[model samples]
Target: MTDDDPISLPAHDWPEFPPGLVWLVGAGPGEPGLLTLQGLHALRAADVIVHDALVDGRILEWRRADTQLEYAGKRGGKPSARQRDISHRLIELSRDGQRVLRLKGGDPFVFGRGGEEAQTLVQAGVPIRVTPGISAGIGGLAYAGIPVTHRDVNQAVTFLTGHDQTGLTPAALDWPALARGSQVLVMYMAMKHLPKIADALLAAGRRPDEPLAIVSNATLPGMRVLETTLGTASHDAEAQSMEAPAIVCLGRVVLMRQAIDWMSQLQGNPPRNPDPLGGGARTTG
Candidate 1:
């Protein structure tokens, strides 16, 4: 149990990573420690690494000295590589008998466009492996001390994106239905359209004073959490000059952050449980 050992599982028991296959791996939400053992193994064996914008650069250090690094990052309003081109590059690399690793930030299936790439690989008749990572919706919220679901607060949670292909608030989303059906909402890439999104939520009967928290640069050193109401979230975020790559969380669970912000607690602050929901009398599971 030395500190050098990252995992307790026996290394010899891990499965072999065959060549001429593309491995779609979730790099986790900005923390190197959060990367899975399978992901680390893939990095160590990958002949070519194709990474996204949100992935921390430190993770690339795990690759072999001869491993080729390729950037396929796509950021909002920034010039970047097209999705199709990246997919083609992956297929080409694997077809050349190279072990390709498509590394992404957070769970690849959760808004990471991993599905699109995987489909392309399948159509190309290339062997592929998928490794799940901790999505920002869950992992980022935890880092901010906001639970996605709590028995006393919400039994259900919904995850959505802030924008669609057209680069606007997703027109396909049924805002009113979402507002009525979901108890908690976790949105990705919503910062740019927060104003319109907030308006829709409010129009759909969501309270103006409903608690919400925006976690930016989640799990990294520069991470910032802005706690505000649905009504003021957009404006408040702008006032603070917050940037993108954030998770927008809305629900009563935001209150729990006051008492469970372990990151803050580590800095000498204590938990503050005001019991806004009046469920303090119940025992915690």
Candidate 2:
């Protein structure tokens, strides 16, 4: 493809992507450097890139001059392009013999609506590639100095969405089971209905004092981490004011922020040792 053509990596740097397929590549949580090697290769080879709102912009700047970039972000509580429309657009681009890359924030299948898009492409007889990235549930929390798993803390981790497609608390919500079962609960799109969700968790058996942490813009310069508890998640979210694309983690592991938080150390603000198992200091909001 010539320079005027959609973006593409040269024959040497990027491998050629099949023309008849769409690649679903996760952009990771925030840091552009966190992109997987395969993910970067696809971005460089793509003729057309349809990226979400949260996909790291720094990463997109790496696209070849021939690439075509389109915004298909579906932000919560905002007028969003229809999911069907986005899927069909991918199909159209591929049918035109263009290599399309659907770049999403975090893992595509991790509440990124990647499964729905893949289903649409499959039904239309289009081929696809799924490249995984670091999900915010884990990566985001990590940046805030929190660990989702520690032998001494949580033995299992459960990831869930804070809102359903209709923008409510995942109406078919099963709070009781989630509260009673998981050791660590990581939530996406949680900033919106955090209060209600936290309440439900408490009412369903989660200890009111259970530790919780919210990390916003994980791995990015503006990233902020709020350490709270199940009962205070909503209130602290309000007081400190977190926003969309943030990750919420709840469990004994939340208390680890003071112990093994490596990101802060990298930023030169390492958390003080607070004894994860002791401090009644539950972070919120």
Candidate 3:
């Protein structure tokens, strides 16, 4: 409601009378129910919603019939709207005096480039607002029964992208420190080059026997988690064949899945056999 203080509730509670401009809203992951009240409000009030492919369809139900909807998804290694073009479009929409809603998956600022869009709008002298949503790193992990942090395992968590456009790990990433630094690691858009990323972590001193859980289609009804050790995650994921729009988590906290495998059991699926080493499997790659 005030500067230096962000509204912490869901999208619905956001102040109705907003500044004349754009609002970058996160739609959470794939689940419609996960949408923040603020996100819901944006959907209803938006004159236009330029959204990504990752956003669920049902969330649009609350919108007025005349609201304009546009797509601007950027999947890894896929054709997407150019970032600059998208930014320019946002400016154009706002210049028309339309309340624009830039809907993104997960928290817009968390790897969603919401900040970049915000910067562009600000530089263009367009007013902008932000609303946070559930990040895949956390909500997605929960779908896989992998906790980001546990008092017994990790007190801290780290989030990173597994690779860059070249299909190689990001050189700018201080991997050596990150690999050795955080107690728990969560990676987004890492499936394509998971092997290289995993190897980097191993070389950087993380235990190969560490637990890894790859949650695909997180928070959706079809969400799947491949449990493995760091050394074998890539292979096992390949063996069973994992798909994208996934989240990968690593650390001892993953073991909690054993007691909390209720999602699987409810679906009549049983746990797989334990590895001979008494350690869980890794599946980042």
Best prediction by lDDT: 1
Query: Candidate 1, after superposition: displacement of residue 117 in Å?
Result: 0.4
Q: Write the per-residue lDDT of candidate 2 for residues 1-285, one digit (tens) a residue.
A: 334554443455544588877999999998988898889888877889999999878889888887899999999878889998999899999899989999999999999999999999999999998999899887788778777887666678988888886788898878898877889998888888888888888889888888888888888999888888888788888899787668888888877887777866777975687575764554664
Global Cα lDDT for candidate 1: 0.92
- Please give the ranking of all candidate structures by lDDT, highest first, separated by commas: 1, 2, 3
Report the C-alpha lDDT of model 1 over 153-266, residue by residue, as the tens digit. Answer: 887999999999989999999999999999999999999999999999999999999999999999999999999999999899999988999999999999889888999999
Off by over 4 Å in 3: 1-13, 17-19, 165-167, 265-285
- How many clashes would you count in candidate 2? 11
**Model 1's TM-score against the true structure:** 0.95
Candidate order (TM-score) = 1, 2, 3
Question: If scored against the real structure, what TM-score would every candidate get?
Answer: 0.95, 0.90, 0.87
Give me the runs in candidate 1 sitting further than 4 Å from their true place.
Answer: 1-9, 274-276
Error of 1 at 19 (Å): 1.9
Error of 2 at 251 (Å): 0.8
- Give each model's whole-structure lDDT: 0.92, 0.85, 0.83
